[model samples]
Target: MPRSLAGFTGAGYDKGRPLLVQALWLTVSTVILGRWWCPNSVRVAMLRAFGAQIGPGVLVRHGVRIHWPWKLSIGADSWVGEDVWILNLEPVNIGANTCISQGVLLCTGSHDRRSPTFEFDNAPITVGSSVWIAARATVLRGVTIGDDATVGATALVTRDVLPGAVVLAPPSADMTSPTN
Candidate 1:
């Protein structure tokens, strides 16, 4: 089978929002929130105005890029650090008191490798309460970081992390035990 871009289609992909609204949000988010050095409160307010279910005391730092605000929900007192990109093609649910460190990428979209036309696939990402995703970590599609779990710096998470598990870099060793 020959691969072709012409055969590619996003028939299964739907943002569940109007085009005008999405465009407005994209413009505002890119030009204003993505570039400016605004305060966290202002950012939160802007996100809420665009239909994001942001809770109280959520701190969003500079250079944070949220792809779709309408599909995002952040719980109370969560801290999203600078340059954190939430590429939420699907819904992204963040629980209370979580810390998403700088340069983290929470992506909810991927391309199917088996498809000849490189079909798009999307899934939701869930980060439970008290979870900590360290700096520069990349959480891939359909991942669930459970409550109290700690994902170490630069770790690439491809699967569901168990509750209270500590995932180190390379993600090979299960650091759940005290002595490994």
Candidate 2:
């Protein structure tokens, strides 16, 4: 069957909150957390107010976009860097001392290719303690990074990373000048 986006309906997907609450979240997020100078305390407080389970000392930087704070749980002392987008249609659990570096995208939603209407295929993302996901990395749905694992910059992680494993981005063309 041919793919038909028009037939697509976001069925079986729970937004986890009412429309009013979502709107309010957007307003607050845009007003405060969106500002570059907004302190991490205020950000944590705001997230907590919205039912997020954010542990103490967790630093959520400015420009970090969380689709649903209620579905987010960050352990103690975790650092979410600037411009990190957590598109958590499902729950995202981040353990203690984890560092989600700048410009990273933790995406929990994807489309089912087999479905003609392209139904949603969502899953949670889990990051274990002491994990380091470097800048510009993309963690797709259903991924789990074990403790002490380091995801290199710009890497696309689509599978589970074992404990203490280091996932690096593939090398591109060499930067050295041609030999004379």
Candidate 3:
């Protein structure tokens, strides 16, 4: 069977905010916050103004891209490093003292391959307290990183991580075997 792009429709996709709001935010984030070298406090203030629930002492580094501030909530003392991308089509909750390192991609949306129309699928992401997601890591939709967990550099997280667990990479042969 031949594939068809004509059937694709984003009719049911709810972008929580309106188009005008999205446009304004995009311009502000891309032109001002993401590009310019601004202080973390300034970025936090902007996020709060747009309805994000950001706690005290949170540090958002330069070049970070947040898709929808309204759907984001970062707890106290969390650090979001440079070039971190939070593509939150759904809610993303980051608990206290978490460290999201540089180039990390926290994506809350994807496309359903099984659907003929290639429909959009979205889910929430939760990062518990003291969690550390290292540089270039990609956390997929609906994955929950438990408290005190550590995700290593360039790892791809597709499932839930248990508390205090360390994820080096995807669940594959590249991972070291557990010692008895």
* Index of the highest-lDDT prediction: 2
Error of 3 at 142 (Å): 0.9
Score residue 87 of candidate 3 by CA lDDT: 96
Relative to the true structure, how large is the alpha-carbon lDDT of every model?
0.92, 0.96, 0.93
- What's model 2's overall lDDT? 0.96
User: Candidate 3 on 48-92: residue-level lDDT in tens?
Assistant: 999999999999999999999999999999999999999999999
Q: Which residue pairs of candidate 3 clash?
A: none
Off by over 4 Å in 1: 171-180
Estimate the overall C-alpha local distance difference test score of candidate 3: 0.93
Q: Rank the candidates by TM-score, best first.
A: 2, 1, 3
Count of clashes, each model: 0, 0, 0
User: Of the candidates numbered 1 and 2, which has the greater lDDT value?
Assistant: 2
Query: Order the candidates by lDDT, highest first — what do you get?
Result: 2, 3, 1
* Model 1 lDDT-worst window of ten: 171-180
lDDT per residue for candidate 2 within 5-73, as digits (tens), equals 999998999999999999999899988887888988899999999989998999998899999999999
TM-score of 1: 0.92
